[model samples]
Target: MTRNRVLRQSKLLCAKGVFECEDLTTLNHGVFMSVKRKMSDEIKSVWSRNGANSYKEARDVVHRVEWEDYQHWLDLQWPKK
Candidate 1:
């Protein structure tokens, strides 16, 4: 099968949370699982409202939350690395 076909098949298999096919070995399966877990967490955090009154209000809060000093925090965490 082609690369696209393999990727499509792998996506379908991942939907079922199982890798019974030989083409998708344990290593590939684990990588997909790890990616899925991370993506799920990111999606949950992005869509979470944290008790906001409405979707628009939640979006406004997220946009207004400042990260202006994020570089300072990063520099503190990793000095000259």
Candidate 2:
């Protein structure tokens, strides 16, 4: 599927509180779940900065964020060398 489609699907999955999916797995982790959990603090900060009114809205904002922007955080969290 296309990148936007995958993002949309991931947002939907997060709304339903279902994080894991076979096709969406990366490094054996659910994309949304990994982002949400690993970067909870940062996500919360972004959510507040964006004035997201609800958890779902925050999640949508998170889904739309650029993954590359968090590369440093990801590297620190996973440290895959």
Candidate 3:
């Protein structure tokens, strides 16, 4: 896939309350620990209202992200600092 498609899907998932995009490295696992963070009420409403299709699309994007082998991103996300 293309770079644009990956970014778009990540944004979609971020909007769904399924994930966050602020630090993208941790997402390599498909599911991130940060998913436990509480979303605002408005975000919750939008997340709940999304259809199964959206969930599937987000999953696909996640898989792609994982396959990309985020070595550099992981370094940035987990810098020695």
Question: Largest TM-score belongs to which candidate?
Answer: 2
What is the overall TM-score of model 2 with all chains considered together? 0.29
Candidate with the larger lDDT of 1 and 3:
1
Better of 2 and 3 by lDDT: 2
lDDT of 1: 0.35
Q: Return the TM-score for candidate 1, rounded to 2 decimals.
A: 0.25
User: Which ranges in model 3 have alpha carbons more than 4 Å from their true place?
Assistant: 2-4, 20-81
Off by over 4 Å in 2: 1-22, 25-31, 41-63, 78-81
The regions of model 1 sitting more than 4 angstroms off are 1-22, 43-81
**Best candidate (score: lDDT):** 2
1-81, model 2: which lDDT tens digit per residue?
Answer: 575575557658788887633443353233345455665654652221122111233345534444454454345574234
Kindly list the per-residue Cα lDDT of model 1 for residues 1-81, writing each as its tens digit. Answer: 564575557658778885433444453334333333433423222221221111123234332212353233233322222
- How close is every model to the real structure, measured as TM-score? 0.25, 0.29, 0.18
Candidates sorted on lDDT, descending: 2, 1, 3
Pairs in clash, predicted candidate 2:
none
Error of 1 at 13 (Å): 14
